[model samples]
Target: MHKPLLVPEFLDRARTHYGDSEAVIATTGERFTYDELGERADRFSAALQERGIEKGDRVAVLDPNTHYHLEAAYGIMQTGAIHTPLNYRLTPDDFAYILSDADVDAIYADYEYAENIEAVRDDVPTETFITNDVDAVEGEWESFDAVLEDAGTEYDRPEMDEDEIITINYTSGTTGDPKGVCRTHRGETIHAYLTVAHQEISDDDVYLWTLPMFHANGWGHIFAVTGIGATHVCTRGIDAAEIFETVREEHVSYMCGAPTVLNMLVDYYIEHEPETTGDAPVRLATAGSAPPEATIRTVEDEFGWYLKHVYGATETGPLITTSDAGRLFEADSDDRFRIKKRQGLAFLGTEIRVVDEDGNDIPRDDETLGEVVVRGNQIMEKYWGKPDATEEAFTDRIEGYYHTGDLATIDEHGMIAIQDRKKDIIISGGENISSIELEDTLFDHPEVSDVAVIPAPSEKWGETPKAFVVPTSGDPDEPGVSEEDLVAFTRDNLAGYKTVHRIEFVAELPTTATGKVQKYELREEEWEDEDQMVGQG
Candidate 1:
């Protein structure tokens, strides 16, 4: 018997294997089972077909994490239409560019974002529009519910190959314009398998959707949860009280989030009473950053939650690696905390290597830094339209390997530690400095909530380290951290050059749509003028 690689097969297996299992529970308080979800997904497919949506048509969905959004993902896949999930926070102009770039034929948007869609309606190639909130619909958009109600249940799924496009994920381009990262059926299915294996999730686990759906298909949990028949609890926005309440009331067993979300939960647990049960403790998976050692300690000690750190980009299905295995440090709390800090080794069927510009493998000495490269089934096929961009990204330095553009060092145990972004490394006075190391140390301070390190001009040393910090409590204009005090604090922890020469407390640091700090923006502001550079040198 041949195996099916399509996404609908996964849904069919769930309905056949665990038909009555609870598939999803909406934040607005609606319960749905696997069988019900499958039926709804099929109904959505039929509705789209009735509107003349054929195979390979681009369909965009703009909404928060909800049951309808999940249904739309599967329904679009069932019809062989590419699912394009849009970030609701993006400006109308950004949305218009993506819509026109992808040549989307139809769009299903929430009531809150209908106006934005209408603003760029004439620019995009959209022929059909469906609004989720019927009462909130304006300017002649069709009702989503009415469309489904009018369409019959009979529908046929298009024949699709494993390499066919399933999703077009737009990555926030820091250097230039945003490009669409196209995901194929084979890539998505392989990544879901990798995630399930690395996370060790089972059918009994109750998954909480803390990460947004628009983010790499919730880091590909949308398929992993369905693959394992896990129950999903969807939350719109990150609210500490709401997250705590849902975890307690629903007894959530597994969830995923960025380090920012984990930091918030740690603060909540410290400030308020935490909910617990005699059953198993919740497992929290975090990525986007390595997470400060303090946040890792708090999650493990105070909340009694097992924290796993994963690392990946939108182009890699966002499930490249996870830190879960226990070493000798498993017995020692301090030692284990340090182990959790590493991005950890690769999952089964994935190979990771740190190589120099010459394409030679670097030693696992834990000190020599090199560009991290990978070869796996989880990597995306290519960027949607720009072939030159895809070629440049994939063929960066070493030949035939996907250059991650992340500088990393591998330890003796084969665990990878991210030094900094390839462009984030600061070269000051002929010495290569890791800004991430400085940022991690500053995060230890009690008053600091967020911190980013960038190079500042220096007359004597060529370039010096500057710290841009965000105070957790005080106003940025007058943060509690004085420049002198912070300098002294760093001098005690780090070396001479590593010590921060200047400090500025800002309201907040710039971040990408997926919550990664935009250090290049800070670099541009600091080194924007030619006269300033001449004077500093």
Candidate 2:
């Protein structure tokens, strides 16, 4: 017998088997058992139904990493309304666009981010507003706690199918207007299962919320960790010292973050050599970009933690592959760091292919670059309300495959390493240069704390590679390394044709809510004066 893979099953199973177990450790120093969390979710379901949120309606939640988000998300999904999460860092106009685009029926914004919603209240179709602290908000809103207390724990759950869209995750509008990526219950369920298998999540593990739950449902750990009956320690935001302290105090065994988070931890380690781990050993899974090998080395050798470098897009499962399988590497091998830096082989039951422009597969020579295409059960159903865009995404360069738009090379072991975004790769004269390669080379320098490489307009070569270096000093004016010396360093390390044409010292790079450097922003600034972008025809 096959049961429909509904998302609510995760919480129901947790409440059944782990009712008395500690489920959530809120940032406000409150703790709740699975039973309590389930009751709260039930209360929310009742409240949403009373507020006229029918099945197939969209419900938006805007909050930092917090238990309220977890409660509200599960509550929304339990009612069969698509749980549409908004990035709290977005602007009021962006919130307006997404809220109006999704036509959300109800919303729960944290006290801090509620004002952004209030500013755009007239622009959205949402009528019922809820906040954790209602008085703290200026607009008409109901208290989450009061709503739950008034809403009796009685509501009918609608029958859900595996193919029903359960969640709508919006992409960061780096390329253009953010697209709502609609995912089915079956896709998310399989993604959670794959995450548990690859990341080795277990009931005894303690998970810290350094990664935002809004970002692909905390990279699907909201379901995976919950389904596994693991303890969740929620945080309002990320900080280096607080993370280490929480790891020791709460015994956080597992967490995931982007490469910027890795850089922050490494920088923190250098400045303050505090104890990095707790009584429980720590494993950090990082994605968003290829982390520098040196950062992986420090995180492993110095911080005494195992690092799992992963890769995927919001259109996919957001975590379709990881690079930390034990069987692939020898015991305590020095070469493992280099191997783990690559986005390793595909996850169980997922298909990853690097295809040329003609839809032909590239060789596994690890040198030829091609666009990464994937066909997986965990891929998104389609872009919400954009049939043409959905058709374009699945039909680009091939049919029936979601084109990742990431240019990469696959090694002999079928592990793929991302070279650059197809739009961001620099075509200097007639040759292609991987900006990731240049950034990785600069990352090895002792003074180069962080770096981002973008294609700057070139008078002769059409476009040339430029480096933005964030020096260890944290001051752009007095960067420890001179631009001339750094230029020589890249020239000595990389191919002669891939030379970095220029270097700019910067205090920090512009990043997205999930800590990915906004290369599109840089590209826009570089090409605003030019007629068109170089890579475009």
RMSD (Å) of each candidate, 1 decimal: 2.3, 1.0
Model 2: lDDT to the true structure: 0.92
Clashing pairs in 1: none
Cα TM-score per model: 0.95, 0.99
| TM-score between model 2 and native | 0.99
Name the regions of candidate 1 deviating beyond 4 angstroms: 276-279, 530-537
Q: Residues 150-187, candidate 2: write the lDDT tens digits.
A: 99999989998999999999999876899999999999
Best by TM-score: 2
Q: Which ten residues in a row have the lowest lDDT in candidate 2?
A: 322-331
Error of 1 at 523 (Å): 3.2
Each model's lDDT: 0.83, 0.92
Cα displacement (Å) at residue 226, model 1 = 1.2
